[model samples]
Target: MLADGGSRGLLRKTFGELGLLSLSAFLFAFSFPSFISVDGLWPLVFIALIPIVPVIHRCSWAAAPFYGAFYGFLSYAVFNYWLTTFHPLAIFIVPVIYAVYFLILFPALKAVDLFFPRYAYWIQAVVWVGYEYLRTQGFLGYPYGNLGYALYKVLPLIQISELTGVWGVSFLIALIGFFLGHALLFTFEYDASFFVSLKVWFSRRKAALAVCSVLLVGTLIFGFVVMRGSYDDQRPWKVALIQHNADTWKGGLPTYRRNLRTMIALSDRALAADEPEAVIWSETAFVPGVDWHSRYRTDSERYALVEELRNYLADKSVPFILGNDDGQKADPGLPPVLSDGRLNRVDYNAVLLYENGKLRQTYRKTHLVPFTEHFPYKKLFPGFYQLLVDHNYHFWEKGTEYTVFETDNGVHFSTPICFEDVFGYLSRRFVRNGADVIVNLTNDSWSGSVAAQMQHMGMAVFRAVELRRSVIRSSNSGMTCTINPDGRLTGMLEPFAEDYYIGSVPIYAERNTLYYHWGDWFPLVMLSLGLVLLLVGGVRKIVLRKS
Candidate 1:
């Protein structure tokens, strides 16, 4: 009877703690762009994870992993709920997969807390940043929704991205959250006076707290200095971005034609206002078969549409950077067999530059979306490829080169198609290869959510700040805007609106940034430190066992 009562009591306690952890996860999720739409609420991110810290500290090491996994599952599921609009299956699968990440993360973090109890706060920051860096690696690496992105509106705080990439900002947030959590736990949970609790906390964590304070103050001062520096003397070039809110996926041929004409009309209206040097279009704006090579131009319907756009550009006499499809014939050496038993010719999602109605430069999309664009390990599983084909998925061949386009007026830019703009290293590569500005062509029509578009645009802002280059983003559904070198959003177009924006972006002659030269070194160093700590821990266990 006593054993049964004890079992029930333990279960009740477990459930109660789980409820508090879930609340913490909810707070964390709400700190992101979707739930907390207002810019000022960004500071809430510093306290979002505080609730989870007590739960972690109170739980046994064996139970800590489960708590961490559950927290991750709840947090990511809420933050990424918008993905369910595109794929209902993702609601279950995405959270489960992301939860596995925290399963590994919490155990490692628990080990740190056990080994270095005194410096747990600082070590926790390192572990969290290391995990974030790991999340951005390889085929499944998705760096979206990192805590740093929440600080996009807090421009001065985010300037540290130039030195430490997004990982540094995430580390600062985690450090502050841990410190505050410790203070709260000491005061309320331990029944101590606030001043006494704070004093105890400061005495125990003086080194970590002092170092974090120095870093915070230094970063803010550096950001203020950088913000005050003038880039006004740089040459400015006027550019027009057009957005035609069309359901390109569902609305068949008729919808495509209407969207194209609407884009042209909007461009015409923008030109009437003032003749811009170049007019930009969103990704996949035209029907397929607009390749630079003539051999792939066999489809008459596609050819006619391409001709119409070319004639319009020629008449306007403005250089156009428009997104379309390009193709090349299958190589005799090696070619993929299609679902229809035909030799697969390579297809590319590309952006083309047109001057006087003639194709001048073609930049194919390099980083394709994981599942939607191309399956990563298809060669290992033929059945997966067949399943994708059965569902009418169009997989694209990855482009090889980092191609840059030069306008007639000698302005240099590189176009990162779709969500490729989210990648910091990819954008840095372009700037290193002589790109003065970063132009992104994207189609966010399928999302059908303003929050998704805004979230995407927010990440792109970091790219501009990291490279000190102007970023021009033209999206099919919305968020057609210009981000200046300082990461300020200007000339923003409304989502789901058929409109255009004309803005002058400064083109600095010199492109110099520490991040542009040394990419993601902060995260790399954190990852290395984590590995060294693990090695040391393993060695210590071995030494103790032998003794």
Candidate 2:
């Protein structure tokens, strides 16, 4: 009986320690979102200071790994809770995979701290930022839910990203975390003689406080100046985004007639209130198939449907754009079998621009989704390809070139479908090639949870800030909105419901962001500096051992 009681007590203590470990980690990561929100500046940076207080107390290097693990689990669990929908196993599995970053982060941090005792915490903090920068780049880069993304709602602070990308804004937040950590540690007492004890150090603490005050003043001044200089009066055009909250599962031919009617009604309402020069609809709003009026038993049925759309726009006299599937007879052959000995070949997903009831331009989606839209091993594994096709997951051939649609209003816009807009370099290519604005058509209905919608929108804000261009995003199942050049959500529609809102997307033509001009070279430079510090620490350790 005593043994059982002892076992329970031990378990309780272990759980208590773990809970503190989690809380300590949470303090460092939790306030990250507020850093980029409409919330004011100083509090976001203040929370970054708390984690270092425990580390500086006795400096137990073992706590670093525990801190890392706790922080990683909390961050991923909160942000990526939607991964469960992709596969039932992902709820536990995704967090385990993401935890590797923290597992690597802390041990490396403790090693740097042990080698460079004078500024070990600062050095570790800087290296931490370098690790974050690396994770968000490269071909396998998944930059979703970064700490900087929490600040997406904070316009004035994020304006600096125009010069440095999201990595730059992340670096600034990291710097604040490290500085606050240092100041907290600076407040501690020293173990020495009466002359060199904390009583005297308390007097010297005033100097440290003064230095921190100066840093605070400098950051505010720099942020204010940058915010003021970011806006340009010489901009280009205004775009209108139409968000039809449609469900992907219910988005087949069965609901085609109803979907068309709802969208037309919304467009008429928008045109009535605030007539935006250009209007856009979400992805896959129209499903194209080979039935071709055979089901209706009339040759003019297909033509009539298109004519209905044309007549509606002509009546209002406004240009319209929407997503549709484009497929045509592949070769010069008989009805069923073409020259390729297959059925009618469909050209994947495309955006159709209708101006004055005439088709003006068509831009096909270039980057296909990895597993959902296109299978990676189609040629190697024919059976897998057959499974994907049979499942009706529309895998389209990727477009070879970037197509910028020219509007009658003299504005050129580029289309980024779904996750394609999340890439910094890809978004850069469009703006660099003379695109006035970036339009995103995404369908988030497959993601049933709110976290997935917010995470996706978070990535979109970073692109707008980095490019210094306006973004009009139209999404299925909510989060449809427009972002100004500085990454503010100028207008937004609610998610997971059937609704539409009209708002003007002011187009800006600034091509002078340092990030746009130079790419990720600056962040790479900071990373190189961290690598040098790591190398120097290793060499110093070797020298000390030899001595």
Candidate 3:
């Protein structure tokens, strides 16, 4: 009977532990994007403190998985919910992968505590960040909703991100969590014995306090440096961002013309004014794949559109860059039309740059959206190709190389579409390729929520600092703005509003940053430390038993 009662108590404790995880998830969801940023309740982040309190007190190794999984679900559900709009199955698969990371993280934390008892929080924070770093590395580096993005509005706090990449901001936040956790859980009443013992033993409070003070001071110093940086120059460049509110519901060529008209009209008005040197448009604003404008049997309709666009730019005497599906040339070694007549070819989604009333250059997107642009492992299961079609998901051929275009002033530009700006490597490459300003042409109307837009915008901030190059983002459903070289938002357009927004982009030659050279080093070092601790713990256990 006593044994039975003990088992019941264990089950109850497990369930309670799981409940704490659910509360954490709820707190995270509430404090994040849609609710916190959009609703303007910035203090909700502190409210999230409620759930984090218990985790520090007892340090639940077993509950870490449950908490991680729960928070992962809540995170993706709200932030990447746009994935589901593309394909419903993604909603399930993504969260499962995210939850698995949490599962791995929690048990590992418990194992580390065995060796680094007093410094478990340090180990835990680093290991967790290392996992996040790994997620942004190789084939699976999806760094969406990373805690670093939470400081999108707090430009002053995130200036250190330029030196450390997103991991720097994440490290500070994690350290704060560690110090708070230790403060809540540890039992030390400052007895005379304890006071004397302090001479021999290091106090966790002193160490945590020191780290916190350093971080706070470092952040302030970084902010002052960024603010005083050259991006604060007030030189104006009469820039224009065209909002072509295209309908994603329709497919094929008919809707493409309608989308072009919307962009063209917006461009006409943009040029009607001071005739800015360059004007930007959202992704896929034009369809140049057909026999349109090119010398090879140009269609009358295409000729007319090109001529009209050229004339429009000539009349305004300004350059325009827009997103379009410039279909591919007949390439050998690639498959022809499938049995369903869906061209297995055609590299869609290319950003065409028109300068001085002529097509100057085009930058094809390199990092295509997973499942949306390229199906994962379609070669393994040919059957999934049909599943892609049934869901109306478009599979565009990936771009082979990075291309940058130059303006008359010798300012080179590279354009990334949609979430491509979120990829730090992609932006870094642009800067490496001699791009003065990074222009991202994206269409986020499908997201249908301001929370998702702000989150997307937040990720762009790191890129500005990473390359030390200004970023000009032109989006269809809001958040069109220019980020200075120091990651400061100089100007912004309102969300869900349709109007031409203009801002001057500071042209600074890309300079090398420490983070741009050696990426993810901090997290790598921490993960290595965690692994070493675990190994030491295992070895010590064996030696003690043998003794």
Best by TM-score: 1
TM-score (all chains, Cα) for each model: 0.93, 0.77, 0.86
Worst 10 residues of 1 by lDDT: 291-300
- Model 2 TM-score is 0.77
Question: Model 2, 17-93: lDDT tens per residue?
Answer: 45644654455434443223212233444455445434533334565566566667776665565666665544564
Please report, in order, the local distance difference test score of every candidate based on alpha carbons: 0.80, 0.66, 0.69
lDDT string for model 3 (211-319, tens) is 7788778897878876685744544355799876554336644566676667777777777765677888888766655222454323566666655555666654467
Best by lDDT: 1
Compared with the true structure, what per-residue lDDT tens digits does model 1 show for residues 1-547?
A: 9999999988987897799778777676667667456232577788886776666667788888788789778888887777877666556656887789988887777777666666666777787888888887776667776878878888888888888887888889988887777666667665578898778778877777788899888878888888886777999988989887775556666776787799899988999999899999899887565663244455566667767777787766788888887776667454344557674577899898988778899998888876678787878988966776676666888998899899778999999999899889899999888899999999887777777788788889899888889999999987788988888887798888888889889997485888987999998898889778867876886788899
Question: Considering only N, C-alpha and C atoms within 3 Å, which residue pairs clash in candidate 3?
Answer: 135-141, 136-141, 289-327
The residue pairs found clashing in candidate 1 are none
Q: Give the TM-score of candidate 3.
A: 0.86
Query: Which of candidates 1 and 3 is the stronger one according to lDDT?
Result: 1
Question: By descending lDDT, how would the candidates be arranged?
Answer: 1, 3, 2
Against the correct fold, how does model 1 do in TM-score? 0.93
